[model samples]
Target: MSIQDTVDEMAPLRPENRHGTDPLMVLNGIRQEFPSSRGRTVHALDGVTLTVERGETLGIVGESGCGKSTLARAALLLRRPTSGEVFFDGKDALSMRGGALRSHRKRAQMVFQDPNDSLDPRYRVQRSVAEPLRAAGVSRADAAERAMAALAQVGVPEDAAWRHPHEFSGGQRQRIAIARAIATEPELVVLDEPTSALDVSIQAQILNLLLELQERQQLTYMFISHNLAVIRHLSHRVAVMYLGRIVEVGPAADVLANPLHPYTTALISAVPEPEATKRERIVLTGDLPSPASRPTGCAFASRCWLATEQCRTEAPPLTTTAMSEPGSGHLVACHRPAEAQEALASGLQLTA
Candidate 1:
């Protein structure tokens, strides 16, 4: 059967839908490597394993070149992984054949970082939004109707839909991009810094729009962003990535309030605070190591002040930490998390 047919058949199944039973989307030991000169490989994603539950928003946060975007592309099977599996709705996503894969593409959609780049200048907002519906085999009449509705849903006016992308503002173009992404009512949406290109005020509007849409349509999101503040607002759980591996994964509240991992603490510290007295800035030292020549142990080890001899010699696997709970589990790939927390409490200046 076609993936769309399969999705239609299984989408009605509520009994099979439970976060604990299995993830709606799963990444198992996935890796993406690019060939470099002199027999070296660029490890964009090094064995990343993640899970997104049904109707849940999972935030992925990391520095640039930390492989979070690559992971998102891998999840959508847009960037083929060098190793491992991508499971979508309990099916082997990577192994999907021909039309099944095409159908899967319809079910999974992406909202890119830049609005200007995503939308075609020549195409009107209505045409851009209707593009997906047309590919989905909807009639031109039905697609046009749906496209206008989508534009309205994303806070664009019915009149704006008739205009070209170049005629609209950045925020408006982004809204149009969002409308196109949700035009087909995708089950999974990968938002890669969807609001980063907009103004601070406009970012909130877009975030609110996304939340409203998710609630209205019961959509699942793999929100990829570097902004912790944005992630905290939109995500139920947050996964912190470094180099190519997940350093920390847990409930947003726990991870933000009491970050166990040193890297997580450093990331959270960088978030700007309104109050001066309460804010403690963590200025990390040096530059992030290149993915092609990652450290032998933890990828964060070179920058991590808490790194011990063991940390340099042995790679820390993401094991179930003590913070794992019923609904939300906190996992940290660090052996010295407790020590790092203690150092933070002692007012130690954390250098990268």
Candidate 2:
């Protein structure tokens, strides 16, 4: 069957694939390795397994070098993973090439971290927005009509569409970028820090715009960022990464309010809270281990204060705990779940 046929056969809005329906996208055992100097291989993404359900935002949060960006690229098939599976809309994405890949690309789009990186200085905003459609064989006149509509949806006026990207502010550039992403009416949009480059107030506007767009189109999103607060705002589900592995994942409210993984707790602790919502800070002492020479067991074991000898010797598999959150079950890969929870229960005074 054709890729479009496969898409047509499936029903949408099924969460966690409970009803035997396929989600928008699924990544299994995705690994991206880069050859470093001195014959060392840097494991950018090490066995990442994730899913983005239809019409829901799955936020990926991690520190720099935790393979968040690499994950995004791998998932989008922009850069194929060193080894793994990428299934989009129930079709084998990694297997697609030529026309199949091209057809599938229409259903999935990406909005990058910096609009400057995506927009061309030479092209006007209208051409930039219409480029994807033109590539898909849409006539110039039709592409322009769709592009104008998309720009209007993102609050970019018809007048601004004729101007160059340099003529717009940073925030406006991002809106144009978003317009280009949705012009094809993609089912999934991988937003890789789409608002990180903008000012704080502008950040809120961009986020609100994204939410509005998603609602209007029933779009799925794989939103990646290091900012937990922003993730909390835009995500329906959250995945926390440490050293190229998912340490924890669940509904946004449950995972943030009651994190089961030590790494997630440390991340949440770092977020400044008001006096009434003050949390016990758990200071992680050691620097993040180099991905080129990762630890033998749990990636975060060295810096995890609650880690035991077992955590050092054996890597923990991501498993569903008794502490699963509502709507979505929580998955955590920590050997010492009880101790990790205890550390937060008691006023965590000691440093890792």
Candidate 3:
């Protein structure tokens, strides 16, 4: 049977579904904290609120250790947030217990950066692919049949299904990992830099597969990556994170093409696009603020050339800038949104 035959149709949209809410997932006031050596708490995620509409890819971009993976796990309730709420399909996921939580988890899956971490070295590719479906209570025989179909969907040959992960190439291993994720028929797949470890040519193949699978399965994705070019290619919307806070977010075209925040510009300017030589002007200096001492005002203030007294003394709420399109929801947390683009062109130089 084709992979299509193994998977059932999706359920009808839930009624009262946040009642007119288009968001399939809603995260509000999400905060995650971990204790450090000196009994100081590291705020990995601080007050992040965002929505992922059904069947859209929301690309999350940021530097390493900016809580991209933490946010991905938190959204799935893998690590309960220190303070906040997560709603999946209008149902509060935080309070779920036993079967309900398992059901929620089944609908949301994650694709990690390394297939070596996600796939067991000892398990046969077929067995690994069938594991989640079996856990979801599928009969062993049926799970085996579906697993083969899933593997085929991702271009794994039927005869190779019995081989261990060690037998596959890096790209093939990732394809199997993707097969395992989609095998359960999840609604949302949180991909944490899934292609970062692959060769550039392999990256394109994996990206193309993800796009095809999303179109076929109507999957919602929270794709986390440091590659802005990849984000621009796969995302309908983009959220730029810094020091555990979203500095800017909006429609992908608007945020990438006309970013209002200095931090967002810095990320875009480093994309290594063909035009990067001429356009790569916004070089941000300084590492992200130390975890033990986060900034009281704007997280980017220490490095921002535009940092004014207001920016240094007070945190700017992420609100719509003057240039933001109405109903488009483009927002930035900058005290001087209007001057960012022009300033960059007119000798606003920042040291790397």
Candidate 4:
């Protein structure tokens, strides 16, 4: 069957399918832009809308400068989008002020990409970890006690709590950072490339630690990374971004195993595969278009081998697609999704 025929056979994803119980975070029509000195606006994020279900990890993956970090910041309310509604646990977070906003911010925490950059070298580990607690009005003694326990939970030695961030190695520092992030017992955590700065072995350790913490604390995560393997391992759902928009989103395993979007297929094809089961790679052409001067049509049309005249003239909406697994939600934005799906099914090599 043709891809469009296949898509037609599937039911559209319902709103309930995209959410569970009460989602921990929701971004509705988020659009972030910055005015350049040249008087043109740089579109950092364009109409990003997604939800992070409580206790599930939603991974955002894309090339650098694809607005992954911008989305993260906007979700955390660190950088309020130029236009959008942010909701936390059904509350309109974008409308909160003063103490209400501070309280909401405490419920969500962030673990940055670099521990060295995130940690204060001069502060002792306990103080660093206790900062959030202190900010939340916890007494110094209680905060210290919680800090020690948090440090211990992440496998940092209790004795090390008295030492500065400079005393620990990169991995240990990240552990400290993780300890600090969770010290306040946040319901949601936004991890921005948390493992990218570490070595391979250390990356595994950190990932495992995060998994452990999630199980123990029922933490919801917005895990952002460019590493497909990492996303596959850690995410319940994955969102694929390009330029300033999410092009594909679905259950992580489904999207990784049967990518329906050309951009997604090209990305997955680049991952290292076992020689015995390797398929031809999809090599894309052309540099990424500047966000300051986005194309009138699909942002990825310039590099898509399957792109047609329609792709060059009109942007595709994020449309729902049939998933192999029942009750799974898969959405892709492409003018030629059917062609891209056929190419993958036929194991046809795509190059541009």
Q: Quick one: best lDDT, which candidate?
A: 4
TM agreement with the true structure for every prediction = 0.91, 0.92, 0.91, 0.92
For residues 1-352, what per-residue lDDT tens digits would candidate 4 score against the true structure?
Answer: 3344533433332334343556778899999999987799999999998888887889899999899999999999999999999999999999999989888878999999999999988899999999999998889999999999999999998789889898889999999999999999999999999999999999999999999999899898899999998997888788999999999988776677667789998887777754537657887887789999999899999999988899999999987755334456678888677777677777656666
Q: Roughly what TM-score does model 4 have, to 2 decimal places?
A: 0.92
Number of clashes in every candidate structure? 2, 0, 1, 0
Better of 1 and 4 by TM-score: 4
Model 3 segments more than 4 A misplaced? 1-21, 275-280, 344-352
Ranking by TM-score: 4, 2, 3, 1
- For the record, the alpha-carbon RMSD of candidate 4 to the native fold, in angstroms, is 4.3
Error of 2 at 32 (Å): 0.6
Clashing pairs in 4: none
Question: For residues 225-328, could you state the per-residue lDDT of candidate 2 as single tens digits?
Answer: 99998998888788998888899987776577667898887887777755536545788886889999999989998888877799898999998877664435
Local distance difference test scores for all models? 0.83, 0.85, 0.84, 0.86
Better of 1 and 2 by lDDT: 2
lDDT string for model 1 (24-97, tens) is: 89899999999998999999999998888788788899999999999988899888899999989989999998
For all the candidates, what are their Cα RMSDs to the real structure?
Answer: 7.9, 7.4, 7.6, 4.3
